[model samples]
Target: MSALSQLDRGVAPIETGMLPRPFVVRSRREELADCVTLELAALDGEPLAFEAGQFTMLYVHGIGEVAISISGDTAKPDSLIQTVRAVGAVSQAICGLAEGARVGVRGPLGNSWPVERAVGKHLMIVAGGLGLAPVRPIIYWALANRDRLKSVDIVYGTRAPDQILFARQLLGLSAADGVRVGITVDLADQDWSGQVGVVTDLIPSMLRDPDETVAMVCGPEIMMRFSGQALVGAGVPAEETFLSMERNMKCGIGWCGHCQLGPHLICRDGPVFAYPAVRDLMSVWEL
Candidate 1:
């Protein structure tokens, strides 16, 4: 995720510019064999304030920087929480950092989800694998104010049971706040009991009027494309749906061409965009 400068939109601006600040790891929790969530405290002791869906530039001292989303509740401004999967050299370095390790924190960056647009509308959050991390803050926000909508449905798919993020919390949240929770896995073990298929298979069962629903999708690019097709096939308008896209980001700022996707720069223009605006672009090969 990338951020427009605080000087631009007032929504949830971080300190302006690309300069990195220091934050100490308060604690870290292993969510899966390859994933961990870090609770960070600013050297100044302030909570990391940001909007839902925004991300930060986390820099490991001897390593480098990588853009990762803020996965903690937006309601909690006193703590910065980021869940990361160990996928590369930088990520591995950050994940391996011990308690009390210090790292540079650049931002609460990028465009956030269209939470404002979804007000009074029923919500459908579709996520695949760790894509749940990007949408987690939005889930927390909507659930915190559950009465403002008709319903909130979460559809998540992973490779298997053990790879699900926030499995324990999803159970409790499902029973409260009238939120409907659905899970599916592409591959399952003998212990798995839920639906077994693609994440899009759960769409038609959502039942809300397509016009009254606002869908938020984030996952593998191909999975998102299929999810978009299913939701639209089920009646949701393309413009009302949003997708959080991921790309190879070199500079969190748009100066570098690294994250370019046609005319839009994924880092600056969005990690979040209305489906209609990006449907064609996302279909481009290797985008």
Candidate 2:
């Protein structure tokens, strides 16, 4: 019998971060050469509720587990969605899973973006590369709550045209009322004619009133740092700007020290933080 089956049936089981819930891969879509977006459904038929900026520890059976951000609409709780980039052993295993494969999930862990704070203000979502996946839920939230928000502006930058994730979806979002989307790339091919520069370069044109804008940025550490600087320089308050920091998180819980940045644990204290909270540490080389 399994270890779980041998446990005393008379006693109540304690919930822990290490215990994984079962989920089945309902569908998977290739977003880029190395990334795939998986739509998961709980085997128990219950919903996996999650906030916009939270991530989950996805376990690939005997392979291992990796923390991945939720990329689906928050309002739709019945289905769990995660975008996985095949960068490591576990993620590679996950990306290779077929439909109907069973996977283990540990959480909707970590804190979330303060999107509600921008209810009455302009919501500016800035992302670079795959960073867009982590912040896509905010876009869904903004679109749904458009009447409550002053404006919704999204600025995205990727290394090249082909590297863009959710390209067609972003195109559709651009046409939404009260929403504006700006896209840029570091390099362009013959078919590309959009802006050719870093995402920070597009900040000026997207910002209508810095004082009234709340910026949420996620990308590589270097990209997020520069984006924060650009937003602050454009007159947005440092506290009004938030960033999602990706680190070497071994455990979704704080038991592991791998995700520590100074006094904060990226997995526990935040993957999402006010720009001012991590600005200094982000500048440190290899810290």
Candidate 3:
């Protein structure tokens, strides 16, 4: 059983800076080299209510806390889901933890994808590299709420076919009702036979009602920039498109300016925003 299963439910999420809450790893999945998807169950009374695209600050005792996106199925909020890529000390430590390990979790922080707004609109989800982690919940939402949208299309790109996230599931989702998935890779070996090139290369073939399409993109800045341009070129409005921004966030709340970009604090105002809102700022390298 998870350590969280034995702990008591604490307090309401009425404030920030509260000591981290106890949570235990219920399960985990290895998606690629250096990446692990942790399914956590909070040892408490009720699970934190979270929307698609939000993130949490996860604390691995003695190491540190890092802002990781909530990567679980939205319908299963009681189960905390986060995907960690071991690119740093803290993430490496998180990746080393096994099932049933205990950790501190302190959020459902940051803003979320505008799923409600995109409900009646056609949808285009673009993800690159580890970017797919943040976009997973939205895909889940789209799948469950397929009737609310005109269409749902996903374009994913990774270092290689081997680096793709949710490889097994993508195969199933490709055949799911009202959803279309297209994948591309930077390079491939003889054993691989999928599309080769950046994700944007597949955008043209995936275009569907760009004028009415609301795109949500989470990826490297360069990839997002080009994807946005391509979508806009295809008639998707800048204001109707969205992107998730990554910054050096210390505190999960707005009190910390570490995640500031122009007049917006990424923690509070967004990790996700309309393309027009931050299009100019995103042009400024590493802001």
Candidate 4:
């Protein structure tokens, strides 16, 4: 392996150029039943370069900071796309904000998915619940560079059929050539005809050369643990599997203690980590 690849084999390098700034909410749209997609423009109307799979700390004037994943690409730096679910006090407050409202933003933080590493390799993305937000950018990146990569597969699971975010967009991508997208719901309705089990159940159906494929996963810890096991069982190497984890992150930077997991800090060392790096901590209750 090359020297840079050798260095990055265990962990991704720390990225630069992301810092806090004030931004304005240019627009907001309801993406799904309870999810809202916010479009943020810089206070001076400039652009911010961000990588796919990275997240930011969104600061509501009086509410507080909440960690959100970047769903847009660096190509369109003038605006940012953040999809949030109204689940907590701060999230509900954010959902209530209107367009033209001003908010504080503190990053394009965290490590991004290894897009370059995934080139020419079969890429498998598994997302569950609101986990789709973190991985959404990679999907767009892959679609834009379809020829450079091999097969692109996405398997997502939601709480219910109505709770599926980016449903139309994903379905359209799945219909296109060289892409496979499967969806599952915990509980199905009469209208639902897709997979009806956990997201792990769909893994076996999408076959690829495990040694030559890279799997990226984001979701609940339990879901990630099970999915990691499934991928290993399907012959994918443990190091080739990456995971985006969610901890109670107070500071998007590493200062706060809320997001720590053992020697690693979810906000700093990861929000995205290789399966082997975090597999041990998955069993620990609080770190």
Q: Between 2 and 4, whose lDDT is larger?
A: 2
lDDT of 1 by residue, 9-94 (tens): 66444344567789999999999998999999999876778999898889998789999999999989888999999999999998
Judged by lDDT relative to the true structure, which candidate is superior, 1 or 2? 2
Tell how far residue 232 is off in model 2, in angstroms: 0.5
Q: Residue-wise lDDT of candidate 2 within 1-287, one digit each (tens)?
A: 33244344433322546678999999999999999999999999989999999999999989998999999999999989999999989999999999999999988999999999999999999999999999999999998999999999999999999999999999777554678999999999999989999999999999999999999999999999999999999999999999999887787778768999999999989999999899999999999
What ranges in model 4 sit over 4 Å off? Answer: 1-20, 175-177
lDDT of each: 0.87, 0.92, 0.87, 0.84
State the lDDT at 211 in candidate 2: 98
Q: After superposition, how far is residue 169 of candidate 1 from its true place, in Å?
A: 0.9
Per-candidate TM vs. native? Answer: 0.93, 0.95, 0.92, 0.91
Alpha-carbon lDDT of model 1: 0.87
Give one digit per residue, the lDDT tens place, for model 4 in 192-231: 8888989999998885788888999999889999999999
Q: What C-alpha lDDT does candidate 3 achieve relative to the native structure?
A: 0.87
Worst 10 residues of 4 by lDDT: 10-19
Residue 176's lDDT in candidate 4: 60
